[model samples]
Target: MDFLSWYDWITPTNPFASLFFGVIFTVIIGITVWIDTKKLKTTTLAMIVGVFVTIFGVTILNFIGFYN
Candidate 1:
């Protein structure tokens, strides 16, 4: 199975679990931003990465038919 299928393991949404993962994801990206001294370059790259990640999340949610 490919990676998108992994969310199937979620089975159901648990508010606390989702919150925990959100914090973890935020922390990781925060650290990456923190370490980069080149403000312009890093900020641009970070924005690109953020947009793509958001699109990817939508794809995953669509694939899983989360709204249905």
Candidate 2:
């Protein structure tokens, strides 16, 4: 199944959905960054920034009536 359908069991309003996906995304990004650079600091920073930006950006989009 596709990624969208993978999360179908999780209702969008559930806070855990966001937390779970955020951690999952962060871990994925961390692995990719580590494989590419082999640096723990860089990987950590990239994962944190990526997760923050993604969540913040989505929140802003929803605020501006983009998601709904």
Candidate 3:
């Protein structure tokens, strides 16, 4: 019950791990943005959103002591 909720709400420990893992995600987003740019598509906004969201989430999770 509570354990499950806690697990769901809490984040993993190790901010460095989060950032390191997040780099992969960020790169993927960058690549997507690049493709979109090549196509002259409107995905740059989405990529930026993703980048910010990922960074915010990771930072909160790692820095808020929720990961512990």
Worst 10 residues of 2 by lDDT: 1-10
lDDT of each: 0.54, 0.68, 0.61
Q: Sort by TM-score, best first: what order?
A: 2, 3, 1
lDDT of 2 by residue, 1-68 (tens): 22344553454433344545666778888899999999989998998898887688557655776534
The total of clashing pairs for model 1 equals 0
What clash count does candidate 3 reach?
0
What tens-digit string does per-residue lDDT give for candidate 3 at 1-27? 132332332443455556555656666
Clashing pairs in 1: none
- In the range 1-65, model 1's lDDT, one tens digit per residue, is 23223363364243333434544565567567857764767755665676566556655765777
Off by over 4 Å in 1: 1-38
Candidate 3: residue 62 Cα off by (Å) = 3.0
lDDT of 1: 0.54
Clashing pairs in 3: none
Q: What is the lDDT of residue 53 in candidate 1?
A: 64
